[model samples]
Target: MTDPCGECGARACEELFHGLLALDHSRAEPWGPLHGVSVSCFLLQHAGRLPADGGAAARGLLQAYLDGGLPAVQRLIGRARAANSHRVKAGAAPGGAARGTAVPVGREAPRGGFTVTIEQVAQGGTFPAAGFPERVRAWAAATLEVSGPHSA
Candidate 1:
């Protein structure tokens, strides 16, 4: 569904994007021990129609982030790191974050339309490297509520 304020909708997307970036920054050290340590993937699924001024919305989001300065980014990273550390201690698996069901809004997506996939590698803890892929796939399958080999 369309947000009453388009600016607010854009800001929400921007915040989520930044949060993912912060998560990446915090996981950097742990991920350093692995191959392809610099790789990251993000998928943003919007509920409604994209704004006509998508380019302008993107530019505004970038400008906002830039105006926030490095200190703000650092703070976000710090908080993410701390939360990740806590999760590790609690025996949670290290990997990309998972979001729950997507709430419907706006116009419905066309039948068999676009699909987004996000993948990330997490390090640290006793998790086996060889089984990581399987775990990720399983998680994706469960999250998307799909069956079969190409669930994600």
Candidate 2:
């Protein structure tokens, strides 16, 4: 295979990539959205804690976190994009900010629901630049066909 994206020294992004693959193999369709959940869980549980915001140092740390999963996320997005199926965009819900809307940091529902948004980052232009988690959530919602609060 031609280094499709000319990935240079991106070995760093492999760890998270493998984790995602493992997830894809083990989970069901609805479980698809769980990609972000599994990743976040792993990040929170392991890989040490990350600071949400800060200076350059903080940004570097976050980048490392992202880079760690860049490759895998790239692969997943490639598969989804190649499938070429359109789904409702995440965050484009009703009564709130649209997908990609930068909101104040707080625990708040973003309008109708979290809409999935995908953007090209680097080589191959299939991977996400930043919205990996949101995309996964959107994928889950679209594939699972579930919404609203669970009746307990």
Candidate 3:
């Protein structure tokens, strides 16, 4: 869990690393235009691993993507970066603004039509491209659907 991007809650930091790394197994960039959605969905679902601004930016981008399309998504990504909104850091600690328990996500992860960790997504597998791009869009859509209404 010491890895800043290990919020996926793998049994071990190595597991988490393998899971996230597996996304690139096909050596193709599937996120493409939906990069914001892919990232935002991942960030928002792991509420326990996100900073306040990160969550807001994620939710906002999803809303923007729905209301204003790619342009809006790009704009929010820029602003989020400026705000230092990003995957939770190791020393960020688990308290206050962070929702959900800071503990590592496990099999007990809630199924909200969205994955709680990169490992889960990887488990779906992506071979010969494995429809990674489509998976990202679908995952983003589901994340938005279960995320409830967005404000601002």
Candidate 4:
């Protein structure tokens, strides 16, 4: 089988999941990169567990990763795009087209569900931008692709 979405080794998933669960439970702000929320939720929904505290202490480092880690992000995006392309070529579904690749109108995709949040934190605070959630989400997905074993 293909790599399990939740098993990707990027620790960002752990952090994002905790932060998002905190947000869902109204404990913490729904703040981080969008990728973080997406991957975090993906892990939670698909894996049935998240790290304790969701790795909050590592959030700043994850955010910095989004802000400056271009190479890692690009590699992840490449893998994701290639994987999606393969799915499309294999006639999996219509909506699985890779990012930055044009998809035909009215194409249906498989039920791959994900969500994200948005927030703004003051400078020197926890989250640095309103779009932090999106960035986090991207990094989380990227890390999953490049970091650890593709399976739990």
lDDT of 1: 0.32
Best by lDDT: 3
TM-score on alpha carbons, each prediction: 0.23, 0.20, 0.50, 0.26
lDDT of 3 by residue, 1-152 (tens): 34434334433434443444555453446534555575566665555545544455567777777677778877866764555544656445333344443433332322334443444444433312465555555556666666553531
Tell me the lDDT of model 2 at 52. 31
Better of 1 and 2 by lDDT: 2
Give the lDDT of residue 91 in candidate 2.
41
Q: What TM-score, to 2 decimals, does candidate 2 have?
A: 0.20
Residue-level lDDT of model 4, residues 1-152, one tens digit each, is 22324443333444545555454454344442234334433433332333332322123334434555634544555565676674466655332312222222343211223332211111222344466545555545443333222222
By lDDT, highest first, what's the ranking? 3, 4, 2, 1
Report, for every candidate in turn, its global Cα lDDT versus the true structure.
Answer: 0.32, 0.33, 0.52, 0.38
Q: Relative to the unseen true structure, what is the C-alpha lDDT of residue 20 in candidate 2, on a scale of 0 to 100?
A: 57
Best by TM-score: 3
Off by over 4 Å in 2: 1-19, 25-30, 47-152
Error of 4 at 28 (Å): 19
Clashing pairs for model 1 are 1-105, 1-106
Backbone clash numbers for all candidates listed? 2, 5, 0, 17
